[model samples]
Target: MGDRATLFPVKHVIALDVGGTGMKAALVRADGTLLHEDRRATGRERGPEAVVAGILDFADELRVLGERRFGEPALAAGVGVPGVIDEARGVAVFAANLGWRDVPLRALLSARLAGVPVALGHDVRTGGLAEGRIGAGQGTDRFLYLALGTGIAGAIGVGGRIDPGAHGSAGEIGHVVVRPGGPPCGCGQSGCLERLASASAVGQSWATACGDPSADAAACARAVEAGDPRARAVWAEAVAALADGLVTGITLLDPRMLIIGGGLAEAGDTLFTPLRAAVSERITFQHLPDIVPAALGDTAGCLGAGLLAWDLLSTEVSA
Candidate 1:
């Protein structure tokens, strides 16, 4: 390691993206370069309190690392977590996947980081912010970021900002019922888009069909690529449901683009080709936005968190 001291201070911020099982963090410079990056398991199995503590511990470690490397503490910090968030209060309202509820994440992080300002955001929306600002939707004024992961979610982006609706759940396109009498969703709705279209759903469907309970969406995509008829049928169903749900979003938002991300999107053309055709066929009066894959992959969340921290500092300075 280099010397722990430096002659001049380098401006940077700490960024953390917390998922159900993992956390990605970075020390980001003002010009968007990731000066340092790290990852760790969320230790969710240890329970929600432990998860929060782990985040705090991780942030502390990053802070110490940054001070050691750059000779300055992070000016501010930002974190993105999965769940229903009360952004105004910086509270994690509910996160079924992480077993979190009403966690004062911003305050906790700020206190842990010796009062460094903290900005907290929802994970998918935060990722969408990065996608719209610097990734696939870059240069587009309006776009919809759809992540087809373990669950499906949408982030409505406009003018380089994510619209966190009135109740803080604006772009929940996944819960939009596409097939009224279809499979049940964890969100307490039957036939929701995620139930039929998410990566997890696709994998479960494929597993049932192929008689392999351990199979996943990537395996299903591989099978489809190999011309497996059963896999093709399964892929087609998920695409159709996704298209239907997207059409509904298009009808409402009329975004300039649709940026698809998450594990299913890893299939590339296997997911996009038929998806585009199906969406085109279903849309009658709605304009079909250009569909593209997410450019940042898994790093979007951490980048977005950095942006969030930068934005917070900007706001503070402006005020």
Candidate 2:
């Protein structure tokens, strides 16, 4: 007869960050180390149901991969998704980009994963949690995480928790009006902060100024570094608008730090140097929060998802 096999248990969790265009997933150990990672297209164009299927399939694949490598299945799963989320009910309430509406994602994932506990969260908020607990905001009691990608969004972290507010839409700083009669926004608001300061907005502004429709935000930054006056003007405008919005946030929340991430932040000092000066110029009474770039980059959301899964496991054990 064959020798008796040793039963060694491996502890790990599945974490997923589902965005409009793609999803990032990982098998994370209990100590926050990643065992494996992968990315998959969200296939949102095929519709919300299809996108849900894609997420589940990708998660299952990660679970199988983890089992194959570690000799055990994941203990739980956590998912971070864009748009408004009903975390209590584990539903993705609305995601305009993904065409999601009231989808019971957590329940579906739990069923798909054979009853593994699942936690669901808003993507930006989850990323903020990671930033606060392990990344740039580490040791800070309060901080604001602003993502300036295709559009602007924020996450408010306080005392190690992300405040989602009563409506689960606490940090929609992108909609805060900065220019009363400026460019229109998809949210039906004119002169919104996102319209003025988001990476897409900056790119459009530079493109229009330079008469090159294809110019992007990175190109604009390069042009500025190359001493292009038009690029400098465009970059300054965005910095001014961003500072205005950030000052407003500081006035209200009084966070200890403001962490900026997303595509616009790739400009590095080109964005931060002017942004600090602009914000300093505006502040009068409120304490100036340290404005810093996000340390985790694109990995924040995935790490935050891992945190959520681990938290859920803890909760289940305590219960």
Candidate 3:
């Protein structure tokens, strides 16, 4: 057994990104190479305990695979999860979508992996770290990453590192009130940016305008391409509101680049053309930052999880 352990490969780490409905995971080499990738249903419908069990089972399988295939278990592990995270304490405080509350994820993972080091991070911020270090924000010193999905959220990158803020909630631009007294947000704010400009918001607006309850942002983008005036109007409204919110972010962060990602960004130039013009039109004293679409798409979060694992290893080595 000892000789077999010595023969096992020891060059990889496990990275996992747990989402609301699914999970993406990988065995990653130190040079950022993905040796293996896999996906699984999060199975939230089965309840939170089941979800946690599934994650542990999946991770353990990967660890065993590493030992069999590479001759050794993974050196470390990193996991990115949604919701409020106490990163300092390695606890997942609350993830509404996952039905998680105060889950000691790092401790659980460490124990499951035979005492391997583990790092836990917020999903958006982890993705942002990838965007800043290796994705769209690479080569830039400072940037703001906005993900305009079901609900808007942001990440701040400074000097090649993502700033988690003093309270672990730094880049929550979605909660910024863009339209005072316009619409009530779940966060107790009226007319929050996400309520106006998120993909869900666009889908709702388009659904109402087109008289199709199932219409979504993609449908709206297609209609705009087809020159439908109603669709154009709805798209314009979202773009304008997004511009207002982005300008607010720019004035404060002054990022050299603004990296946009998420579902709405799939609209391609349709969203960017109007959004760029609107943001340019709105800025006064703030320097206009270069706006670009996210390059890594859905893979950013998984890759960022790998980075977190590697960072953990590096930190240990240096210490």
Q: How do the predictions measure up, each by TM-score? A: 0.98, 0.96, 0.95
Error of 2 at 5 (Å): 13
Q: What 10-residue stretch in candidate 1 is worst by lDDT?
A: 1-10
User: Which regions of candidate 1 are displaced past 4 Å?
Assistant: 1-7
- Candidate 1 lDDT, tens digit per residue, 1-319? 4646567777999999999989999999877789888999999999999999999999999999889888889999999999899899999999998998999999999999999999999899999999999899999999999989999998999999999999889889999999998887788889999999999999999999999999999999999999999999999999999999999999999999999999999999999999999999999988889999999999999999999999999999999
Best by TM-score: 1
lDDT of 2 by residue, 30-73 (tens): 77787778898999999999999999999988877777777778
Over 4 Å off, model 3: 1-10
As a whole number from 0 to 100, the lDDT of residue 303 in candidate 3 is 85
TM-score of 2: 0.96
* lDDT of candidates 1 onward, in order: 0.94, 0.92, 0.91
Report the error of model 3 at residue 306, Å: 0.6
Clashing pairs in 3: 8-71, 8-72, 9-70, 9-71, 9-72
